[model samples]
Target chain A: MLNTLFSGDFPRSRWLTGLLLLIAVALLLAPFLFPGSRPLDTAAKVCIFIVLVASYDLLLGYTGVVSFAHTVFFGMGAYGAAIALAKVGPGWGALLTGGALGVLSAMVLALLIALFSLRVRAIFFAMVTLAVASAFAILVSQLFHITGGEDGLSYSLPRELTPAFRLVQDKVFDVRIDGRLLTYYLVLTACAGLFLGLLRLVNSPFGRVLQAIRENEFRAEALGYRTVLYRTLASCIAAGVAALAGVMMAVWARYTGPETTLSMDIMVNILLMVVIGGMGTLYGAVVGATLFVLAQNYLQTLMAGLSSAVSGVPVLPNLFAPDRWLLWLGVLFILSVYFFPTGLVGRLRGTGSGR
Target chain B: MSGSFESLLARLRGGDGARRSGLLLIVALMLLALAGVGSLPTWITLTLAGLAMGMMVFIMASGLTLVFGLMDVLNFGHGAFISLGAFVGVSVMAALGPWMESASLAVNLAAVLAGAIIGMVVTGLFGYVFERLVVMPVYGNHLKQILITMGGLIVVEQLIYVVWGPDAIPIPRPETLKGALTFGDVVLEKYRLLAVAVGLVIFATMTAVLTRTKIGLLVRAGVENSEMVESLGYPVTRLFIAVFIAGSALAGLGGVMWGLYEEVITAHMGMSVMVMVFIVVIIGGLGSVEGCFLGALLVGLMNNYVAYLAPKMALGSSILLMVVILMWRPEGLLPVAKGR
Candidate 1:
């Protein structure tokens, strides 16, 4: 599988490979080495968002499409799984069935939207998608009987995946790892596999064509490539993979809602992640998502210290408050876009030129 | 009906050709349909309500329309201006409670004007900093523009929360603008009437500035061919800054009006308006102020009428309106005549 993935490469892609390998190793060892649930949970979230953001990059970075409807696909995956699990109850059978159904439905939705709107100018298509996607979110919440409305639906996971189904009660390295650790590992492996799959797809000939389309749509059309079909296919593929990420999100959080899964905030976050990690570079997704989720998880506590330090200062405490980390994240996002348009990965590769 | 409205708007915006009339005629027909479902008085009330809402939307969206039209900047952070305006206006009004509570119309109007002036000035000044610090970096890169502007929005919203507190705050209408005006069996809310009047004044001012003056001429010419205007030795850069400041001020003004209309302000209020603003901008044409006016009115009327007639469909009505509009005219209701 590695040979197949690397076959077309010129073999100059060393740094990204090394970085990705380092992350993979860290994720594998996290359960044993990480001491607390907070960090572990954050790690798991980073994993899910890595796939989610990379799939978005597939469209934005690769195919030169800016879609605002990505979270809808992500939401569909969670909702599909949540609704299915609610109906089928919890088991390996239920999980697989619901997850498969969820992923497939998300792909279908993406495909339909792409096919319908891809013909318009890029900006107009974006607006159409935005309106449609927001409507979908509202519709989901309004379907109170089926969707549980604003409350959102949560269902049980398989018993073996639950924390109570412990392989052992205690831990090594002062880490009390057991069934919950197993869940993290489950999420890790799935996420890693999905990330690898995305990397391979982007490195493949199809991905090269997508890059070509992004570089110059008319030139690609002149070369006889079916641009619309390719874009639509890319959208479908990205959506399918995003749905997989969504399934993992549901499995991890055991909950999904409009705010968590379908909000425009999440959509913007994914966009920021992809851009900050660097567009057109697959590893950027992992790097960006990891950076973002970590910052979100840890920045508040970091800010909390600052807030308290400034407590003696009038008005400074409020400005430095922990809850205002999103404000900081926003600043970081803008700064990254301005100074590191190639993103962290791109800068790491010593390519500072903007995408 | 469509033709008449288009011609009217064409004359108003100084465009030579008739634009799409579907929106105006369709909106009128929708009102007619609503009249069939409810009493005449009910329809009139809803119509007035919609016009007021539409007026507010236009006030907010016109700035966006002009900025996008002139600079080609897809400002995702336009919401920040709105939020800033609301916060500034509310803060000013909160501090001037006694003036607002005065029974004298002149005094009440003074307080409101004071609030709006402060809101506009502060937002305009912030627009300068925002343009320099944030927007300047991502010039000509739409993707980066969107991402960075959104970042600007988030930071500004957080700042608002820090400054104004996260909870929604009430901002009552001035005493003189607080009640309704009744004419026999038909009644009109005073605030709505004020909104309509203010909307018209803003629209007229915008039209006059765009059509009658040198800056307006340059802006219109810039919209048609910015490079050409630049080749004529005009400082397009300065013009860009002026337009940005103007657009920010307009958004602030609209925000103040909207806050008063809703009687509550929050950090996320800007976001709530962003969707409708975008919808209106799209339906109007990316850069056409006149189309923005028509589109806002259409969305406003449709939203109110539909909410009253079918509450379940209300959430999707504006979106559905956009879809319908797109189906009929893919380039928008009245696309810029040249290269968009």
Candidate 2:
């Protein structure tokens, strides 16, 4: 049953399995164990990002394609849900329809980009996607009537998912069983389910083909797999999953904007997570998202402490400033690319070289 | 001997027929824009603006194409050098504020020259270090190259923020280079004219060196087949380093020019301009200098004309141009000796 649950692809290492279990347990009881809005928000972000980063892994890790437009699909989904909710009101129908619209739009855009560029060299795809994604972002901001421009859109969810909605009259374990908790649980459940779905997809025969393409595209093509078709399909799947993640984010935050879902910084963060966690492994997304989101949320506070501590030193305080976190992350990203290449999951699994 | 020289020239030109066609495309685009606007003055003004923008883009893109042509390394971090150049140049000019603000043309020119020279030198040195530290480790691997360079870009951008305090620095044009030259209601910015002149000089000088000089021959030959050039006793590694530094210096010069043109410099400017550079390189074809030049001009003109005629389509015009060009010629307008 356990084997079937994991799609017969185990973590393959005891430490990895243990870490995964620990994360799972901590996440499952996050509200009860860590009773705070900030922690809950961070946890929710991690849950959402796991799916986002994992979907990216499907492209970069599995298919050997580095697309800068992952955020475009993500934005489409977020905007789709946000627009739908704003227009149709905050009911389940509006939410689901918006999410579906977002996913479908993302899939179509991904399909178009894939069909158009994947036929060329891999590098061309990267450049083209960057151009297209930036253009899309500018277009979104310009179309203020629909997208709310830079300020973004904010709307409430269904009453059952709002903070005002009370699930239980009294506090449970010193925590109000309100719609916030309900929304958090909903996001967690959806993320886990989506994550498993990605795992199952990757472990399947189709996924093996993607891995084969990543390992050697020419070899895969020579073996009669029709490389472009497979790559395009993989991109579509990744796009769909990414959009779903975007929808989840919209539902949680009750706000969607270019800065949140479509910014280059978010794109860079996604790349960092995928690389630092481990490319080509679904678990890498889980581990990377958790660690990165945690760092993102708390690293500034930690840096603030360090900055103040080193106030007497020249340059040290500036280097340790709260906003300078990306510098360290950037340094770590380069080191990971150079030293590990397979990320922490790969390191834990002893697959140091990735291949 | 003269026949051999002519053949060498021909070889350097790469594709004479394709080159003419690319130039014709530029002319055709201008004519098309003229037809759309119908006013000669507006068209000329737009054309001049487009040419100036094209030239600046070309200055920045030239180094990137040369680097890619000679060494199949796509340095995504090339933008860091641009940002660094802008910051350094602006700082130098800022320091020489009195000279920059002087009414005397010589003093104003001198200040600007100091900024340009120092900016180039600083970026040149930075490129050398960047080549050694960030780029040297990941050679011949496109995937790692992109990822690592992107990592370098992020780090350098963050460093710029740390150093410059994450604020946009605004710059005023040098006294002599400000304002416009009007030809009977056909007005042109003085700085834009200078940009065009500088771009042409660089292009002409590059052309002369590539066709007439031994080093240029070697660089061209190396682009075609580095191993052959290496076997022929030329240190390809040294050539690669030289090209990399020169390319970086040119990018710096472009950065200074761009910063002056925009009248503002931000840490993120490099990355933003990088998208345009990438588009230019792709449209010009990777590893092709002439192609890059033509591509930049085409994009510049397209952007200017579109922005004038249909404001809404301005953002998408260059991208749309890129898509159309790719469909027409997958290898770009003028692919180099061995297209990547």
Candidate 3:
């Protein structure tokens, strides 16, 4: 049953399997194990990013397509939910409606972009997407009446999902049984289901063709596969899943804005997580998201400590300033591309040179 | 002179008349704008503003296109150099505050020149290191090149934040260059005129180098087929490095101009302008200078006209132009035929 669940693609390396199990257990029991709002928030974010980055990997790693527009779809999903909830009033029905709206729009936009630009060279597609995504971001900001502009949209969730509503009359396992906890679990569950769906999609016969296309498009086409059709399909699927991740984010944060969802920084962060986790391996997304989120949360505190420790130094404090953490991550990203192009999961699984 | 002009036109048109069509498109766009705008002075001002903006974009994009042409290396981190150039140039201008503030045109010009030269030198040197460290390893692989260059971009941007702080620095234009040049009812900004002149000089010099020099021939040949050039005993690698440095230097010069034009400099400015730069590069064709120039002008003119006509639609004008142009000519307005 477990093998079937994973589509028979087990984490071949024992260490990898162990790490995956540990992450799963920790996330599953996050409320009980962590027992704090911040920790729980971090856990929830890890879940959303895992799905987001994995969906990206489906295109970048599995299909060998580099798209800068993934975040645009993510933004669409987020805005769709934000606007729907704001307009329709927050409820489970609203959530579902927003999510469906987000998913459909993302798919349509992705389809249009794929059909129009996918016929061109990969580099050309990357440029076109970058241009389009930036333009979309501008449009969103300009049409502030609908999107709340740069300030973003913040609205209430269903009563049961708000912190004011308690799930139980008393505390359970030293944790407050409030709507927040329920929402976390809801996000976690949705992410798990979405992630599993992606695993199933990538491991199917359709997935094998994507990998084949990634390896050699000419050969795949010569072998009678319509490469563009498959690529376009892969792009659409990735876009839809990315939108779903955005919906999950909206539910968790109860707010949506261009800064949080559509910014180029978020796009860069997604790229970093996907690359550092290991491309082509679904498990990498889980590991990457966990590591990146944890680092994002804790690394600043660590840097603050180091900065104070070297208070008297001339330039060292600035270098180790908490905000400069991305500099180190950038350096790490470059090094990984050169030395460990396969990423941490790839290394653990004993995958040789990167594909 | 007329005969020489005819010969130049013939050269630009080449065998396929790509450049001629690109030129005609630019004319058509202006005519459309003239009709829509109706007022000739407003049209002239908009056209001049558009041309100046186009010149600045061309300066930034020319090097990028050549680098892409010479080696299929699309440096996603090209914006890093642009930012670096702007920051460095601004710093130099700040240091030369006295000269910059002077009422004399020559002194103010000298200060700006100093900033541009120093900025170019620093960015050029950085580009060499960037080529060696960030770009050299990912040759021949498009995906890795994109990833690695992007990595370089992030690191450099963060480093800029660390060094310059996360504040937008205001740039003071020279005293003589601050006001507008009045041509009867049509007034043009003095800084923009300088920009146009600088852009024209760079464009002319670049054209001369590419067409009239031995290195230019080798670079052009290298872009078409580096291996063949190498087998013919030219050092293709050295040529590529030179092109990369030159490209970085030009981007730095553009950065300086862009900073003064905006009257402010920010690290993120490079990234923001990069969208326009990419549009221009793609519209012009990957490696063609003439194409890049025409593309930049088209985007710039379209941007001003659209913004003036409909502020809301202004955001998408360049992108709309790109899509339309791409639909018409998939390889761009003037594609440099590349040999694999």
Tens-digit per-residue lDDT, B209-305, candidate 2: 8879999999998888898999899999999999999999989988999999999999999888989998999999888888999999999999999
lDDT of model 1 at position B284: 82
**Ten residues in a row with the worst lDDT in model 3 chain A?**
A346-355
What range of 10 consecutive residues in model 3 chain B has the weakest lDDT sum? B7-16
Error of 2 at A61 (Å): 0.7
Per-residue accuracy of model 2 over A285-337 as CA lDDT, tens digit each: 98999999999988999999999999998888888999999999999999999
DockQ by candidate, in order: 0.60, 0.77, 0.77
Candidate 2 regions off by >4 Å?
A: A351-355, B1-14
- Per-residue alpha-carbon lDDT of model 1 for B110-219, expressed as tens digits? 99899999999999999989998888877777766777787888889999999888899988899999979887767899999989999999999999999889999999
Better of 1 and 2 by lDDT: 2
Alpha-carbon error at B237 in model 3, in Å?
0.5
**Clashing residue pairs for model 3:** B284-B291
